[model samples]
Target: MDKIKLSKEEYENAVDEIRKFFECERDEDIGNLQGQIMMDFILEKIGPSIYNKAIDDMQKYMTEKIDDMYGYMIP
Candidate 1:
């Protein structure tokens, strides 16, 4: 996939969220710059696997729902 780019505002927002999550999950408050770095690392190392798993799950869910529809009958 092409390199994913976020606007500055969006990137800042993501960093803010990362800070909040670090605080919540680890009881540690991290600075915005640290958050940004962490987010970049995560996106590079883990994001594609997570994204692919979500897509696979969505496809499985849709396939099951479509099969259910096919099994339905008019009353």
Candidate 2:
């Protein structure tokens, strides 16, 4: 797939919308299904390249959060 470029504003808006959608799920199983649907919608709307980039960015953000939490727990 060709690279799909997004302006900063567009990326922020997409992230906000995705977070809101996930917020509506009541449990982990439902949230996972909702996340998959959200991802499919995003991929369909934005294409693979942009979707993959978003996924990578989110993974990095989550890893940083986990590391921060681990650091807080260590002596």
Candidate 3:
């Protein structure tokens, strides 16, 4: 599948959407609902395949960073 390239502004907007999704006044309230709604909107805009690939890439990057930090700590 071809990668969808986004401008810096577009990428920032997507990040904002994700942040708004999980940021709520109360964690025990309907925050998750709002988050899910935001996620659905984002997924609809980005498409499922791209969304999944982006998420997977982010996870891999984070894991690698953590591993690198762990390696440095052992020295």
Best by TM-score: 1
Candidate 1 global Cα RMSD: 3.0
Candidate 3: C-alpha RMSD to true structure equals 12.5
| Pairwise TM-score winner, candidates 1 and 3 | 1
> How well does each candidate superpose onto the true structure, as a TM-score?
0.70, 0.39, 0.38
If the candidates were sorted by their TM-score against the true structure, best first, what order would they fall in? 1, 2, 3
Q: Which stretches of candidate 2 lie over 4 Å from their true place?
A: 1-46
Model 3, residue 66: C-alpha shift (Å): 0.3
Model 3, 7-70: lDDT tens per residue? 7676667656666544553343334455556655655676767778889999999999999999
* TM-score of model 1 (CA atoms): 0.70
Instruction: Report the C-alpha lDDT of model 2 over 1-75, residue by residue, as the tens digit.
Output: 655556767766666566665566642334444555665567568688667888999999999999999999957
Question: Please, what is the whole-model Cα lDDT of each candidate in the order they appear?
Answer: 0.87, 0.67, 0.65
- Stretches off by above 4 angstroms in model 3 are 1-46
- Model 2: weakest 10-residue lDDT segment is 26-35
